[model samples]
Structure formats: structure tokens, C-alpha cells
Target: MRAVGIAVFLGLLAGAWSQVASPVLRPDCDALEVEEAALVAQDYMNSQLTHGYKYALNQIDEVKTIPRPDGGENYVVEMDLLETKCHVLDPTPVANCTVRPRQETKVEADCDVVLSKVGGVLSVVAYKCKSEPESAEDVCLGCPQLVPLNDTSALQLVDASLGRFNRVLDNDTARFALLEVDRLATKPLAGTPQYLAEYAIIETNCTNDDDDNCVPLASPVARKGFCVAAGTPAFTAAVDCALFTNEVAPVDPTLNGTGPVAPPVVPKLQTTHGLKHHHRLSSVNVPAATGLLSESEESQEVVPVVKRQAPMDTLLELPVVPAVPLPPAAAPVLQLCPGRKRHF
Candidate 1:
């Protein structure tokens, strides 16, 4: 019996050794994609923002990017609109966001960081965003006191820039920027007229060369943008050109349920063919030394101006862009321990 007992113990020890407890090792392929997607998402958002801000604000700077939960980060695109907070994350002490269908997807992101107006005054980045799972067309998301985008005050900047002629709104330079917003996101006008003005500005400003800065209104490459903006059949000719590129088919307007169209109350400036647009004559001698952009050149290249007889469209035309960038040298990063910091 003693020998048998010793043999049983040995067998138990052998079985335990054969199935020894071990740390589970994950395969690279099997690792969850959340982190990777989050990284991509962070980068994607930043790229779009850099593209948006450089054009919208003439420059992009003072970025305070912070990490998100899923290995991503959020940035401070426009930090100035503290009164109404109609902008991106800034002034607010905390920032938050949620992935749709939160239960189905464990992914989420949020960040907290300080914002400052070091360079040019931080303008608000008009967002085509939904504040919560359920929001009405007339109301701003999250903040009740906040006015809807359709409000005159919400778009006061554009109106101020476009409405007055003798006193050109210095900020009217944003006109050329609007169309690129639509091109980048492909979302039609939200409930705001500011977006509409922005669209008009983009279409008017786009040239083959400056699609990076302004939107090409009648480009041969993308008919969808022209289709939305064009009432005349010039769009068809543009579509015929092989240059038009819409990687995906036309989106279904009716796919979603009944929603708010652009609020008529949203202001409308004088547009050719009743479409919110800028029009210029075919023949005009524009100078190239002062960054003065003719309608054609504005869309095609960044050049100087000779300022001829002011056409109707020149009312809100962009002034000569600074031939140079602002704050020539980079600003010092806000360091926690200046000169005393150590890096690992």
C-alpha cells in the first residue's frame, strides 16, 4: 500500500507538470484592432484638421494633442469660441466623446488639455457634429444656452465679412475655405447657413492648383461637388471629363429619414443663377506681385494683385495672403520643468 500511494502521488505530479500553468501569449495577428484603429483614427482626425485649419484660418498652430483611451489622441483645432462654445475642444475644462452603440463596441475616446491663443486668434472650427445620441435640428448639442448654427449670430462672422463692402470683413478670407470642408467630409449643408456660405466660398475659390487651399467649384475631376453646386449644365460637361473622380457612387439623399434642410432663415448673399456663388468676368488683367488673386487665379494659384475696376464678386474677395508665414520661428513648448526635465 505504501508503494502504491507513492506511485499515485508521482502520477499526480506528472499530470500537473504536463499541464503546467502558463501566461497566455497573444499572437500578433490575434491582438485586438482597437489600439491600431484608434491610432489610425487619431491620425485621420489630425490630418483632416490640419487640412481644414490651414485653409480656414490661413494658418494652423498651437495644437495641444492628448492621448485617448484606445491609443488615440484629440487636438485643439479652434479654441476661441468660449462664449457659445460653437467650436472644437477648448476653454472647457474637460472633453468627452462616445462611440456610437457603445455597448456593442468597447472603444471610446476623450481628452483634457489647456488651450491658448498664442498665434493668430484661435477661430472656431465649425463642426458637422451631433452632440448626443438624440438631438433636434434647432438646438445645439450638449449646451442649451448655445444657439443653433442657423442663428445670425452663429454665422455673424461670415455675414460680417460678406455683407459690408467698403469695410471688408478681414475674416472674409474664410470664403474660399468653405468648399473644401464639403469636399473633405462630403456631408451636405447641416442646419446652418454658415456652412452654405462656406460651400459657396469653396466653389468660388477652387482652382486646379489650390484645391489644397480652396475648393474647385467646377473641377473636371469631381462632378459631385460641381453637381451639388452647379445649376447650369456646365456640370454635365465637367462630368464628361475623365478627370472627375468620385471613388464611390452618388450618395442617396433619401437614405436617411426626413431631416432639416438648410434653414431658409439662414442668410443668403447675392449669388449668380440664384445659387450661392461668386462670379467674375472672363477677361481681366490681374497683377501677380501683391498676392491679389483674380477669380480664376484664386482658384488656380496664389498670386499677387494689380486691383483693377472692382467687379461685383470682388466684394468679399480675399486680400493678398501674407507672402510669409506668421511667428517665423516656432514657439517654445509649454514645459513642466523647463531645462530641468529628464527624458527616459
Candidate 2:
């Protein structure tokens, strides 16, 4: 009887060890899977772009796999929107199918393709494509309110903070449209709870390089911020206040909150080089070194002014000044005659 009991225990332990050692097989998705998901997205876009709307298929910008809660995966494909039309079109190909140039406008849309597998069969769980509409004040509805970090329970604080950040970016009026929340982690700031949210920002029409007649907008700058939970309920008002009042510190508090977190550290942005700087002579000629120049001399010897032309599309390169090295501390002088002798 004792031998039998020991054998039974050993068998159970072996079974547990096997379960731990064996790798769990997860559903693998590849380019083919992404293509299948994109087809679903295309169908959805077509449905929305029928009758009056028209859009051309652009290249896929990105394809990301997000693990779902039910052991499934969601393939999110980011593609260019190209252009869209607002007028009705004829069914026939050669008929009046062509939308009027005046009625058509270039627009961008975001599409999310969610795929799931049930019983080893893959199917699209959700498909949606939302185009960015004209800027309106009401687009920022239901933005998260700012509450004191300590007041909110830890269980829901992260979700609340993230939801607020997303709402602000999803709106049309914002300079930078929030693409994705890459990293969001919380840390204590001098005993106060604070969040460090790292996100991706895409330049929308409001912030892009467009015509001078376009609305004057702020640049789509940094995408990371050291946000603290403290503000009113108003979405826009709260964000404005937080922007001005929030403590700009390091993402990781362990590193010593020394300075503001750096920006544009994304892999794509880092790999792509900015436009080269070009120096050109200005059309207007000025006097050489002398403060005053004779009218005749100005006409005769035109001093070509060297000016930098920064085009709207090109990135401006600022001159980098070399940092001056600080002098080493002077050696400590020991004077025995002026004061009491130093005991060694």
C-alpha cells in the first residue's frame, strides 16, 4: 500500500512537470493572414465608400498583431486613404461615374481589422474605417476628466488616464492625431502617483505643411509626456491646464527626475534622415562690411547675402555649438603658515 501511494505521487509530479515544460501553441499569423484581414477591411471600406463616397486604395503603412483576451489575435493594418469623393456616382464604368473635381476632396481614414479563430477557423471579428472629418469642437466629446491621482483607485487609474489621452488625440482639432499608445507606465513622483505615457502622433492637416491660407496651427511636436492626475472635468480645458501645469520630468523616476523626456525616438523616425540643409545667396544685395554704402557702389558691387532657405517640407538644421569643457577643479592648497598645521 505505501509503494502504491508513492508511485501515484510521483506520477502526478511528472504530469505537472510535463505541463510546465511543454510550450503552449499559440495561433501564428503571417503576411497571408494579414492579407486576409486586409480583404475584410477593403470590403468594409467599399461599403462605406459606395453611392456618394469614393476612395482609392493606398499602400499599407503598418500591420500589427494584437493578442486578444480569448486566445485570438487582431491584425491592425494602417493604410493610406488617398482621396475620397462626396458626390453620387453612376453604376456604369464609362458613364457619369466620374465624380466632379469640385465635389471630390483628399482625405485620410484609419482602419482596424480584427481577426479571431474559433475551433481552428479564422474569421474577421470586427472591421471599421473612420475618416478624419473637418475640425469641429464637438469631436472631443467624452474626454476623460482629470482627478487627483491619489483619489482614484489603482485598479482603474491606468485605464482612466489612457482613455483620456486617447480621446484628446482622436479629436480633429488636435495638432497631432494620436496613432498608438506605445508605452504607458506609472511611477511615483515625490510620493505622488504619476503616469508616463509614450504615444505616436501623426501630422494631420491642421499641423501639416500646407498653404499659407490654411489655419495657423501648432507643430505636431513631442509624443511623450509626464502626466499627473490633476485637473477639472472639461476635456479641452483640462488638457490645456495640464499641459501648462503638469511636471515635465523623466519617464522613469528611478533615473532621477532630471529633465524632460526626449522625443521622436521611434524606429521609423530614427531610420529616416531629414532633408539636407542648403545654403543659398539671397536675391537682395547689401553693403559689405561698411555700415553705409553709396547708391552707385551698391549697384556696382552687390554683396550677395548668404541666407538659409527652409522649405515647408524640408527639415531645418540648426547649427550645433560644441559644448565648452569646464576647467578641472584647482588642487586643494594646504597652508601651514597662515593657520594651524594640518595633522596627517
Worst 10 residues of 2 by lDDT: 269-278
Clashes per candidate, residues 3 or more apart or on different chains: 14, 0
The TM-score measured for candidate 1 stands at: 0.20
List CA RMSD, all candidates.
Answer: 29.7, 34.8
Best candidate, lDDT-wise? 2
lDDT per residue as tens, model 1, 55-102:
111111113232334443333221111011111111122123222222
Best TM-score goes to which candidate? Answer: 2
- Model 2, 105-212: lDDT tens per residue? 223444434445444445444443445432334223332222222332431443444345545533433343433332222344455445433223333354333342
Which residue runs of candidate 2 sit more than 4 Å off their true CA positions? 1-32, 48-51, 66-73, 84-104, 117-122, 133-344
Q: Against the unseen true structure, what C-alpha lDDT does each candidate score?
A: 0.24, 0.34
Residue 168 displacement in candidate 2 (angstroms): 52
Provide TM-scores for the models. Answer: 0.20, 0.24
Cα displacement (angstroms), candidate 1, residue 120, comes to 40
